[model samples]
Target: MSEILHSPGVLALELSPGATPSSFTLGREAADALARHIADDLLRLLPAERDGAGADQADLLVLGALYDSVQLLHPGWPLFAGLSELAHHSQALAGAEGGRIVAFGSHAGAMPGDALQPLVSDPPSPLLLVPWTFSAPEALATDLGARMESVFMAKGEAGRATADFLMRTLGVRLEHARYLTRHDLCALICSQLEHAGYSALWQMLEFALLYPTRSGEASTARGQKLVFRDGAVHCALPVYADWAAAFGAGRSREERVTDYAGWLFELRQYVALLGAHGVAVRFDGDAGATSLPAQRLAEPDPSLPPPTLFSHEARGLGVVVISVAQIAPDRRVRLLAHAWPLDQAGFDVGLPQFAARYGASEQLVRLGGIELDATADDLAVTLPGPAMH
Candidate 1:
């Protein structure tokens, strides 16, 4: 069987972290202009060939959305397949092609339906990516890929006219516009995560992106460990047996629970970050234990029996239930807790409501979690903000 080949690439517009854009996409005329500029830049960057091995033969497909790099890594919607299909259909339309450039603008009569809609900007890492492709033999494809990667890294800035036009039309603060192979885009995202103090977590995330067939493990400085495998992130919650032996063994139960609360808060932050990156998360009591759906930690209700204690409820009741279970004869037990919904508004306010209704001592033992006795007041503790790495 002959091997099938597809060469797909993306040109990214990376904005400063704090930079703001008024619109997520461009209007028709502006989109067309940007597409033209991309074509011109690529033609100048890639040498012309008699056999059409240059940018002249390439296809540039522009979309009207800012993208997060992780969205590009979605296994469900492989980037090359999606872009190629879009380009194929667009190219077949008699008037849609403009010398190898096709822009998917909001005002363009051919807007994709919601199901096929691309991922839009969130918190705005705000990469306006224009994906391009080439049809060539395997060797020519490899050579073209190398040269594009090299030249784009060296001098891929958008032309002056293009930059000005983007700023004026899209109302964005221009930072740096560059060409990136899809791989380069992933590296750029990994670099940004490292700079943002997620260096430890980046390794697993990168593996989830590039090495989906294998598993990867990593740990945060605070001792939280995570593994990426089978298309989801399985995190070993901090209050597990091994972690307790190292950090909680000598501490009082109250102190241990307090420290555990802090760790639980940090886990929430990680979950939010992963969600932003479009990755699924699950919980593991130990590094090698059977994984539990992350929702168990996200919305816990220990009001039921032992096994069902960790089962998740559809709606979060605005409090974390630290459910305790005995697993051994030596007084060893497991403590499972969840964090408040960080995404909801007035969540902190819900904290007080929970405390007022539960009372201090009555609910802890009744809930089948830790028996806080008279000091149950501590269970309603206010968690601190995301800890700085």
Candidate 2:
């Protein structure tokens, strides 16, 4: 039982950006090339599911880092609407069970100097925007460490107190209960103790058992010395089967098992309470599985003129690349472009213009009229700036 409690399985997935081809730029050729690549990857990654079947047969899906906006390629639609539509489609095809989607966005503070302020009010999607001001990696790590330590100490003390109470209530000798750790003993006590009496016993043990300590040495005239300890002494007694049997006669074994199980439940509740109060105790089975659907777009007709490219320069600063991807049955299509630096010097100034150019290009593709719906948001693209000279 103890061994089973100690071992649990967990799975982790990390998504990273793929390499950009040297020929890639903020133009039609780059957009078409990226779109093709993304489509291929998504098809390979997401398994096609049969209708009326449960996800039990489906594989787990984890989205590590998803960026870029397909709406940027087709400015005619609302940005968030496009994103939502795409998410819906992707989740439907992927099968929701055991799925997780974690998107990465730059903390606004990470932007150059004061460039973050203007964008603060109307920040991008909550799922997409992680403000730089609040997302310091080093700071978050340090705080998490402190929180974990505090939680560990609190849980340890609680377990010890619970164990001591069990020993006293059941009249079990401390020596007989030494085989169990404080946590195990606590679990045993909770399982065996009456619900009505458990809280009082817990409070009593807490008030009397946990505290501070001191020690002193006394020397006799003959030079023999002895040590005496004072202040506070904290100790926990072990749990014994006899104490459990004493609680009920006919079903002693069943009662003992029930008591143990009850204790485990209470301990879990306590942990959750601590978390609600901002204590960071790590627990298994705490998070829910989530999924986002892929995006689809209508295909464009071949008779239309080749898509035109719009270029934006950021003065002395490098290009702000924007790429978008749309998901289709056979593959994921992407759109690539860049924002011209606004000589006007405000965060909101040139963004809409860049979005418009990108969006129009996407609309051209959709008009070609492919049978498959290229969910607009299903596409993924990158935004790499100019190389630092």
Candidate 3:
């Protein structure tokens, strides 16, 4: 059993768009160049801490993969587990002399994906990381960890030559290359998501990542509820009552009903974020008085376009269909909401035709197999276009 190191660090690269290669992976030459430069950087950062023989500073092993900019979910557990394992292996092989560096690079191509899915993101975010571990005596490791963070924060720029080499080879416009502990990375991501109006979503994600063993709960601005436990997210979709409490306060009942579409849009946005994180979302149907039960479908019903929102002129709004893939069949089941719109074309016109003309019906989020209990009579409508506003 390889134990996780007490002190793990990361080299942070802040990249701006500048004709950068689509992939984040560095080939043999680039990877080797990066490793050498990182070694030099570490040497300069800690000149006093040489190995026992005083021949080399420490063992800094950089992983071959360049990791994509992740949301800092789970601090660094499974995300950086492989790096920890690699360091342990190297130490065992070499008798454990020094610290290790685990690097994660990326390219839009053949590189393996992490626990987080959608390996390839459109318009990649402006960040990349190289994770490393510091192996030393407990006292020295603690002191070194504190020093490493401050050193990298203040003067952790990559060597000028290395930065130039990377810019030319990777084709990314350079912003600033520095170092940060995993804690720093977590705070950075939290701030970023908060600035982007995702504070509520971050709360749940952070809890899911950091508190995997404990049960926790979170809610969206629109009153959608989420419970995290047993390695999955259980969501209780807001009913008309919950929706009204959030958005219908001052407005008349009719006006609130008319604006119901706004709530549906918000729900879709939340679902999309969960899917993007590859979070297994289980719609909790029995928690509230509203009986909105959801179950797993053997396969996606091709007849219906993915998970969509359907609306009609007279009916105000129709159903907000939601579908999520089956992640753990034994412990959990996926969810899908089924509902139809009210149109003059009558029930005979069918959702397919009704969606084509009156309601443009946009697919909200599509994952895997899931089904909703048809008991909820309050199916609403969806607007046109797929993008969440």
Best by TM-score: 1
Which portions of model 2 miss their true places by more than 4 Å? Answer: 1-250, 271-389
lDDT of 2 by residue, 144-185 (tens): 223323332233221233234323432332321112222332
Sort the candidates on lDDT, descending order: 1, 3, 2
Residue 313, model 3: lDDT of 28
Candidate 3: count of backbone clashes, pairs at least 3 residues apart or interchain: 26
Off by over 4 Å in 3: 1-3, 49-58, 71-76, 87-118, 135-140, 215-218, 252-259, 286-319, 322-389
Question: What is the RMSD, in Å, between candidate 2 and the native fold over all Cα?
Answer: 35.1
TM-score of 2: 0.14
* Candidate lDDT (C-alpha), each: 0.55, 0.25, 0.52
lDDT by residue (306-365, candidate 1, tens digit) is 321221112223234433232222323333333233334324443333333222111233
Predicted candidate 3 versus true structure: per-residue lDDT over 162-228, tens digit per residue: 6787678767767877767776776787898789877777776776666667788876665667777
Off by over 4 Å in 1: 1-4, 16-19, 49-52, 76-80, 92-99, 108-111, 115-123, 126-128, 135-139, 237-242, 249-258, 285-318, 322-389
Number of the predicted model whose lDDT against the real structure is largest? 1
- Could you estimate the TM-score for every candidate? 0.68, 0.14, 0.64
